[model samples]
Target: MTDPERELNFAREIIGQRGFRDVPTDEVLGEAERLLNGWMAGDFRMERPKLYDHYALLLLALLQKNRDLEARIEALEARDA
Candidate 1:
C-alpha cells in the first residue's frame, strides 16, 4: 500500500484499539517527531522510507485535530461560564 493508505490504516487500527476520545495523541506525536527528525538527519535508516512520510503526515493530522478539539471544548466551557 501507498504511504497515505498505510497511514490511514494505522490510524484506523489505533482508533479501533483505543477509542477516539482515548487516543494517546501526545505520545504518538512525540514518537512521530523523533522518528521523522532522525530520518531527516540521517541518524536512522529504514528499508522503507514511506513509513517516515506516513507517520509525519499522521502526526500533523493528529496535532491539528487535537488543537481543534481543544478549541471547541474551550469555547463550550466559556459559553457555559
Candidate 2:
C-alpha cells in the first residue's frame, strides 16, 4: 500500500505556479542542503547557487516521479484486488 494522496500533495504543493515560481529562499536552500548531504556530497563543486539554475528541472523531474509512482501503485492495487 502507498499514501498516494500524500505523495500527490507534496508534488502538487511544489509544482503549483506560485509555489514553483516563488519558492521561499530559505526552503530552497534547505532542499539543496538535503541534496548535498545525500547525493552531491562526493561532488564538492555542486554548490547551492548552482542548484538554483536547475530548480525548475528538479521540480519537473519530481512531478514525473510522482506520476510514475501513482501509476505503479494503481497497477499493484488493480492486480491484487
Candidate 3:
C-alpha cells in the first residue's frame, strides 16, 4: 500500500481501538485538512527546509553539547565537595 494509505490505516486502527468518542474528531480532521491544503498550496516552500535544518541543529546541540554541559557541572560539583 501507498504511504498515505498506510498512514490512514494506522490512524484508523488506533482511533478504532481507543474508541475516541470523547475526543474532537472533527477538529482533528479539520486540522489535517488545513495542513494538507497548506502543503498542496506550497506554503512550506522555504519553511520546510528551514524547519528540517533547525530541528537537526536543535537535536545535535541538545544531544551533543547538553551531555558535555552535564559532565562539566558534575565535575564542578565534585570539586566543591
Best-fitting candidate, scored by TM-score: 1
Q: Flag clash pairs in model 3.
A: none
Residue 28 error, candidate 1, Å: 0.4
Predictions ranked by TM-score, top down? 1, 2, 3
**Candidate 3 per-residue C-alpha lDDT over 2-80 given as tens digits, one digit per residue, 9 for 90 to 100:** 2332222222322345544443545335444554454467542224444443343234434555677899999999999
**TM-score, every prediction:** 0.45, 0.41, 0.35
Q: What is the C-alpha lDDT of each candidate?
A: 0.58, 0.52, 0.45
lDDT of 2 by residue, 1-81 (tens): 323232222323333566554665445445545554544444233434545656664566556667878999999999999
Q: Tens-digit lDDT track for model 1 on 1-81?
A: 224323233333334566555656665566556655655676655446456445654666587778989999999999999
* CA RMSD (A), model 2: 14.9
Candidate with better lDDT, 1 vs 3: 1
Best by lDDT: 1
Q: Count the backbone clashes (under 3 Å) in each candidate.
A: 0, 0, 0
